[model samples]
Every structure is written in C-alpha cells, then in structure tokens.
Target: MEIVQIFGFALVTLVFAVTLRQQKPEMALIVSLVAGAVIFLLMLRKIGAVVNVFNDLAARANVNLVYLGVVLKIVGIAYIADFGAQICRDAGEGALGAKIEFAAKILILVLAVPVVLAVLDTLMRIIE
Candidate 1:
C-alpha cells in the first residue's frame, strides 16, 4: 500500500539523515529536504483526487467556483507554509520557522475576509 511505502521511505530517510548528521551536517539537511520533496510529490496525486472531489461537490451544491478557489488557495498556503517552517526548524532556525507560521496566519486571515463577509451578510439577511 502507499502508506506502507511512504512509511518505509520515511524510516530509511530518517536513518540516513541521522547517520549523515554525525558527519556532514549540511549534506544531512540536503538529504532531508530532498526526501521531503519526494514525499510531497508522491502525495500530490492524492491531493489532486481530493481537489477533484471538492470540485464535484461544489458543483452539486451550486457553490461558486471563486469561493472554492479561494478556500483551496488558503489551504495551499497553510500547507506550504507549514512545510517551509518545518524545513527551517530542521535547519535550526526556529525563529525563522515561527515567522513563517505567523505570516501564514496573517495571509490566511486576509484570504478568508471575503468568505467571512459573505457569511455575515447572509446571516443579516436571514435575521432581517
């Protein structure tokens, strides 16, 4: 199964990283980054399937594609930010990682503003 394969790859990478960390720290970081990229690429297919499902459901519910796109963008930003932050942390830059996360939060809030306004407007109409 894919999960098993992923786990196996992760285990092997962990061991290799650990071994390299004792010798060449820079190369160890590089290996970690490459392994992370590989895993991310492997999961992209699954992510695509999920996006397709969301699109189908949105169509059935008559939801606007623009809103869906915005939501997806927010999610994408969150994931990418998290990945980057993790990488920074692994490279011993905790402060940088924290900054990345903070920026991501601000970006998510900005992206969500329109959706929040739409919901508030709908609620006001219902109460009127």
Candidate 2:
C-alpha cells in the first residue's frame, strides 16, 4: 500500500516534471527535486522502524553502539549522496554528480576508520 502510494505519487510527479520541462527546464528540475524530497520524507517512518530493528539486533548480538551508529551514518550518507548525485545528473550536471559521489566515498571511508581499526586490533590480539 505504501509502495503503491509512492509509485502513484512518483508517476504524477513525472508527468508534471515532463510538462514543466518543455516550458521551463529550471522549474522542471526544481519540481523533480521537491518531489524527491517529499518521497524521502514519506519514507522516514519506515526508515526509523528499520533503525529500531537494527538497534534491537545489535543489542542482542552484543555489538557496540558506537560501531552501529557509525555504520548507520555511513548508510545515511551513501543514500543522501546518491540522491543528490542523481538530482545533479537529472539537471544535466553529470560532473557535479560524480564529484558528490567522490565526496561521499571519502566521507564513508573516514567514518569507517574506527570500525576497521577495531577489527584489525581484534585480529592482532587473536594472532598473539
């Protein structure tokens, strides 16, 4: 039902965006971006539910909250970056989209450092 709603909304948005694209290309892009934002907003409740499930799982598994938090942050960044990059590409700015993706990758790496370091440290202790 939610997906059906999302699809219906997207279809309507696509129609409007296409219509606007003919008369005012800039306006078309704005409409597309705003539609995307609305869709993301609509999905927030689902996202929160997923996060709660992950939190519960992490607790049961005895996983550190910090690492779980970092992982969630990384996923959030990836999704947001992809969304932005797609918008840029839609606006005929492929180069800008690529730059956004590059920045996101660097940020993900930075956020992952602590997790990587912890794994390596655990491995070292096991070997010793």
Candidate 3:
C-alpha cells in the first residue's frame, strides 16, 4: 500500500515537473524537492519499524547497545548521504554529488573503526 502510494505520487510529480521544466526550470526543481521531502517523510514509519525490529533482536541477543547505536548511525549517514547526492545530481551537479558520496564513505569508515577494533580484540582473545 505504501509503495503503491509512493509510486503514484512520484508519477504525478514527474508529470507535473516535466510540464513545468520547459517553461520554468526553477519551479520544476522546487516541485521535485518538495516531492522528495514528502516521500521521505512518508517512508519514515517504515524506517522506524525496521529500527524497532533490530532493537528487539539486539535486546534478545544481549549485544552491546553501543554497537547498535553505531550501526544505526552508519545507516542514517548512508541514507542522508544518498539523499543529498541524489539532490545534487538532480540539480546537474554530479561532481558535487560524487564528493558527498566520498565524504559519506569516509564518515562511515570512521564510525565503524571502534566496532572493528572490538571485534578484532574478541577474535584475538578467542585464538589465544
């Protein structure tokens, strides 16, 4: 149901944007940006649902919440970075989009380092 609504909304927005793009490029961009925001807002519920599931699983597994927080941060960064890049690309700034993607990757790596170190430590202890 949500996917169907999303697709329908996107289709309508595209048609409108296409019609407006030739006469007014700025207006088309505005329309597109607004549509993107609305779609993202609509999908937040689903994202929250997934996060809840993961939280429950982590609780049952007795894993450290710090790792879960880090993972959620990474996922959040990925989504935000992708959204920003897409917006830049839509505005005809592919190079800027690429830079945003690179920054996102670096951030993700930095955020993941602590978890990676913890895992390595655990593995070394097991071997010893």
In order, the Cα lDDT scores of the candidates are 0.95, 0.96, 0.96
Off by over 4 Å in 1: none
Q: Model 1 over residues 1-128: C-alpha lDDT tens digits?
A: 98999999999999999999999999999999999999999988999999999999999999999899999999999999999999999999999999999999999999999999999999999999
Instruction: Tell me the TM-score of model 1.
Output: 0.96
Write candidate 2's Cα lDDT for 10-94 as tens digits.
9999999999999998899899999999999988899899999999999999999999999999999999999999989998999
Give TM-scores for every candidate, taking all chains together and pairing residue i with residue i.
Answer: 0.96, 0.95, 0.97
- Quote the positional error of residue 68 for candidate 2 in Å: 0.2
Cα lDDT tens digits, model 3, 6-58, are: 99999999999999999999999999999999998988899999999999999
Candidate 3 runs further than 4 Å off? none
Ranking of candidates on TM-score, top first: 3, 1, 2
Candidate 2's C-alpha lDDT?
A: 0.96
The true-versus-predicted C-alpha distance at residue 121 of model 2, in Å, is 0.7
Q: Using alpha carbons, what is the TM-score of model 3? A: 0.97
Candidate 2: minimum summed lDDT over ten consecutive residues — where? Answer: 39-48
